[model samples]
Target: MKKRYFIWFLTGFLMLNCSCNDWLDVNPRTEMKEEDMYQSEKGFKNVMNGIYIQLASKDLYGKNTSYYFPDLLAGYWYKTNNSTENYIMSYLYSNSYVENVIKTIWSKYYTVIAHINDLLENLDKTDVHFTNGNKELLYGEAYGLRAFLHLDVLRLFGPVPVGASDGTNAIPYVTELTRDPSKLVSVTYGEVKRMILEDLDRAEKYLAADPFMLGSMYDLNNPGGNGVNYTPDDDWHYYRQTHFNIYAVDATRARFYQWIGDKTQAEIYAKKVVGVKNTDETDKFVLATNSSYTSSEKGALVMASEHVFAVNCSDLQDIINGVMITSSSSRPKLYLQNAWISSVYENPESDNRSKGGRYFQTDGSYAYYLKYYESGTIAATDMVPLIRLAEMYLILIENSTLTEAREYFEIFRQARGMDFAISIGDETARKNQVEKEYRKDFWGEGQMFYYYKRQNKTSWSIPQSVTIPENGFVIPKPKGQSAFE
Candidate 1:
């Protein structure tokens, strides 16, 4: 087990850049011992921020997992126009390019997991005192992130549906800093599910105690009775939306329950997020408006308010310019299937999602996502959204009765400038409608593939008459990991 874990550690070291001069940098693991790194509260904060920085890298949410790769697999993009692009669209696991992509994803995620484990293991021993609830906040973020990363890994690399009785091997849910190879064994899909729920449960407990969730009295800027006079620099509470706050944890619960086929539990959690009663908690997330996308500023995007958890990525523009199909450049464009666009955005003029949601080239031959659009002025704090309230509504609709589902769906549709009087015929029609909305809403955000997998859809249409294979449902465990075999 020690050797197995060590192999992963080495792989992470080789694949990940241990040093960056930017704010995201974590001193190379060699320079700072684990004990020294956690000796101060500032050190703990650095590790937490570093994990987000790494997560925002091109390898994970920044590209492969969200914006670029999975969008193609989900049938959102048109057929490939080049060999390298073909590797992704075709789900070509045997291709060396695809192999390296999968390996990087596996190693990088475990790398973050390892760092998180180190934090959890050493947190109790820290000599640093955390006043103003910093300790709880740090721990809450750590646990929530651990669950978040592991769940995404399971979604991407673990078995589909995650309730398989065939005893298919799933990714290991590493919860400790293991030097012992014997402890590095992988868990089954069901076991991982339980472990994730356990982590989220702990996260909820800790995050519920967070100052940011305590009400207006705890607002960092207001500092009400606390009298801390907390500035933005001193107040980590200022950016609760960026971290996995309590609501985000609840939203995650909704997602987890939906994944495991527990509709009752899923709907309960989703309602907590949607805040059907219009409680203070739900005010944290507001639906995006037309100006949200059309405006040039960072927070202008209406979906920005809807984000429950996001990672700040200063280099987002560079990533978009390089890969996306912007009007200015088409070197490595990602084209949308026209049929899909028409199916989802039937009433383009009234649909805010179509009229001012994601941008398209003037020729209308391809559409480019503006979800991550940020200007030079706002570049300092650009974020990649991970969880949001819209997803909660989707989860509720997915598991509800036709009438109930349509009610939830109409709320979302009307918010996006569509008619609220729309109706669905039956359960099948409702399901299809729910799916179309997901494809429309989460186009570039990277939820489509997982959505398909969760539904256990055997086949789907992409452009150029291509059909995703059954084997394509699960990315094979990276080569040479006999444990995954």
Candidate 2:
């Protein structure tokens, strides 16, 4: 076995126009090119290491798109430039932050992707010294990460013309980063989804079936979380899990499919991850609901249950989940969106069994938002749950009938403290309720706003039914040149 766990090197300088030149230029870690970096196994590891550092960078995970956009789309509203503007404007108004965030997110992801592209180019040429299993693991993760990065870039920023007005519209695909001739090419939404799915399809097989394999077994763990001089896993573990090879990416693929209206594939991937969750203890996070605190199973499930597709909220993954929950404890924080709050709040009283099992702040805010995440309770820190039990099956049900869908969905309902009773209704009403349940259960999870917008087929509108302009759909590329470029 490798001495340490997982995967990689250092390029210390941030090289950002956003930062002062004094700070960024002073700390340039060893500057190396892809050819020089990946010459040996250790060299390849170095290149991969840079990829993880990029993932955790402020522009991407630390403080950029994923962190900012969700709040803008779902939370309390403010001006587009308001210090606390969340996801509302991008979804509701025609604004630039959304574009900026998308651009930054794209930039960060491709930086990681360029490393993968470089690794893929070089690794294939290296002599086989390690087991094929290890080699597959490396390339598999590279592909999966590449696929996911592309999907996210396209998902939030890519345009879908609801009507024929898009004949003049373009939903461009950026398979490789663009540079040379400086000309831009655009593809429609349907065409981009096709390519996105193809990347994911390659990942499904090349990627590992289990993400927590390292986390679940001795392969990943350390006694006091102190083990350096790592092997394949830890050296580049963040790149592996945070970027491409993560468990959540599988479900992310499902989500990407669902966004483009592919139910059968969505259900296939969802079933793979349904009810398989990473607990706070396992992932090293805190789950706080009022009275129940960590003791409440409801609180536990809220933090990291088998819910699908969450960005792992740990230094282990990238950046912290969010700011500390705004309370005395100053614990790690996770943002929950309004759509999620409303859906969970709207559930019938009889539905939630774990309601009694959660925490509540004595201070009178809304009982809904603070109860689960109050810093006063399980106060280590919580990761952002990009996906979860309740929403996974709920999506399945929305695409299914009362019987077929209910079989898969009840597991989530039970987990959410909902008592299962098939609400009889017209087909449309039942499906609508399923969609609503997903909305409530998944508020502020990040992906919901897009789902709601897509569910325009159902009632998935932003806070208001503003028609998203086709021109507004593109999130401009971030600043940098990559192998793709």
Candidate 3:
């Protein structure tokens, strides 16, 4: 969910047969032709679906990447976790392997940009007769999605702004259709942000309200944490992986504003989400009870009240009803870090109880719970959560004062069965505790890293611990010249 790589896709499309990272062959099908791709409604649908398939690759958002600090900050991953050591090694050391992934991600993101550029250019050229609502929404979605990818990468690699339009630089803005991305010069990060904001501004006008706007109990009570819930409304909507809507725009705005340090905009969108409270609990989105999902399952994407955006994972059903583990060291699968697992074991007891099994204990530490790949038999599990309803609530909590923090904190906490009523007056204490819960519940979900960077808090260290990274809370400019050297 953290990474938004489109490199495999770029290579697949460009090299035609070159094996880059992971993705299928790039040969054009008999049905596709340069001119015919946008000739009809079916062609349009086919193009969009292809975009989704490429976009949804594990590299893009399915698998986390270094260009994304949310994973780094979230503390869900560490340099020492056993199940994910190979993945963690290069990241911790900034080695060539991690660099290749970053390079691929950078390339793929631009490819996506190129593809969007082509779509927009061609779509703009066509005088298509369309049903009133469909064309606008679809194009708006296309723009929004394109902007989302562009903005996300910049957030991780661009430099901070200290002056005027001469802001810190960014990776090249791959906004034009091109066969040679390497020749492109990088643009200013501020410019990229400006364009992204502009796109979202257009998107804001075109997109509709949250799809799950109808009141439901599941929406109101969907947060799964104790002492202060975040994104309560997002919790209400539920549908595994699929298309994004207005909430996606809202959440992205909130997140983007938060990154640029525009707390007002952040708080505004955060509040807008909160205002859409869900009255009925039954409508809350959860794992489809007793239903096995396939690797191809688009995923039960978040509905209005459930989530804003999420990673469509290959769940266990692809491995035949959970008989085989999805994330093996070989083929691999999305997963929670062991530290993540270790932290969620909230009920480790000498005496066994129904809920006790949920908690894990290793000598002195508690554990976390993940329903995916637990027995090593889970060859397929599709539970990769990206941006959920809980995020907004946490954003609100972060927006609160010390006294106000406890008020909302208790509201969120009580929902998750934690009895601790928080009302701390210390700013430092409030930030720390709020962050702790955020880290604990939102781990494998992929929000941990940014929360840390946004608050100017410490980065992840070891389990049951935290450390402020000396690197500061800025995603440094891409390594160039001597740095990339």
Candidate 4:
């Protein structure tokens, strides 16, 4: 594990340069003893930040797990017939190209896990180095990240949750810091979910003092009645949204519960997040208002205010320029067919989330996803949104009684600039309404695929609906060493 994971290191000068917003931006390099490095507070921070940096790599959330590959899997992109993208849209796991992509995703996922394990193992010993409750923040972020990654892996590679038995072999829930391959073992899907929740339990406990919980009091500019004056000591604690803060943990719990066919538990966690308020009783995280997305600066394309947790990708502009954007030439892009875009956002002229809206840029026949749009003047624009406030409302819509579902969704709908209330006749109608919101709201976020999988849909819209095969929803684990591997 040590050999494979990025060796986290920071020079004295490098530590001098880190600021509140960019503390997590430093890359790992050089060889140093764990004892020597962990003796300082910055060293621990660099390691935690390094894990996030690696997660933003192309093999992970930076591309494959974010908007690119997963969206293709969900049939969001317009694929030419017989192209590799088309093959993926067809769920052709056995195709050589698709298989290799799967292998890379699997290997990279575990490699990052190895990095996380290293941090978790060394945390307890270095407790003395942290101050101002930073130690607990590190522990909380680490545990929450572990749960987040493992849950995503399970969602992609584990069995479809609709009818699968809990005791079936899912994937290895790796917690060990050891490099010895024999020590790892695969657990049942049920066990995996149990372990994920347990890690989240630790994360929530440790993050009780997280700055995000402080509401308006956490602002350095405001300082508030807590009697805590702003100082350099608080730098690392300021950017709570970019870290896996307390609300993010609850949001993850809500997501995981919904996945496991536990609607009651899902609603409980989702509601907890929905009810959160700040010192002044304002929403800690609110859904994006019309002006939030329509601002001339274009900084809030990813809906910055709503992000419960997001990764700040420093090279986000490079991704936008190189991979996602549309060009004059015929090279395929992450293009949303114009018709499909119109289909999803029924009120394209009125809905703020639509084609002529702030979220997309139309060229000829298709549109470019602008969630990760290039707007670097504001630092918040660089975020790769993972979890946000809107999903909590969507979760409630799925799990709550019909009247409650309508009420929750109406708030969400209004937030997205949709006027008029939905008249959902029954649970099925309510869910169908929720699906439309997910399709429009989560575009380019890599969530639509999971939403379809969780519903265990027999057929899905590749824009034009088609039947999904028995094994289509599951991506095969690499031609592996073992289930444990």
Model 1 stretches astray by more than 4 angstroms: 1-30, 166-168, 215-234, 276-282, 291-297, 300-302, 325-330, 337-340, 356-358, 375-381, 462-466, 483-485
Question: Candidate 2's residue-wise lDDT over 213-233, tens digit each?
Answer: 444312232322443222343
Q: Which lDDT tens digits does candidate 3 get at residues 1-485?
A: 12222333345254222122222222243213445556665455555555655554445554443213345444443344443344433233254555555556666666666667767666676666655354555566677777788776766555433322546566566656655535466677677788888887776666654333442323223345343223423321333224555656777787787777776787788667555543343333332211212132222222222455554444223421211122333322222343444344333122111123332212223232333333332232253545565666666677755565676666666544454344556877777666766655554445566565555555454343555444544443334422432
Report the lDDT tens digits of candidate 4 across residue range 226-272.
54444335777766787889999999999999999899999999999
**What is residue 365's positional error in candidate 1, in angstroms?**
2.9
**Of candidates 4 and 3, the better by lDDT:** 4
Best prediction by lDDT: 4
Q: lDDT of each structure?
A: 0.70, 0.47, 0.50, 0.75
What's the residue-level lDDT of 216 in candidate 2?
34
Best by TM-score: 4
Each model's backbone clash number: 8, 42, 68, 0
Instruction: Point out the higher-scoring one by TM-score: 2 or 3.
Output: 3
Task: Quote the lDDT for 185 in model 1.
Answer: 61
> What lDDT does candidate 3 reach at residue 467?
58
TM-score of every candidate: 0.87, 0.68, 0.70, 0.88
TM-score of 3: 0.70
The residue-level lDDT of candidate 1 at 303 comes to 68
Local lDDT at 459 for model 2: 28
Q: If both were scored by TM-score, which would come out higher, candidate 3 or candidate 4?
A: 4
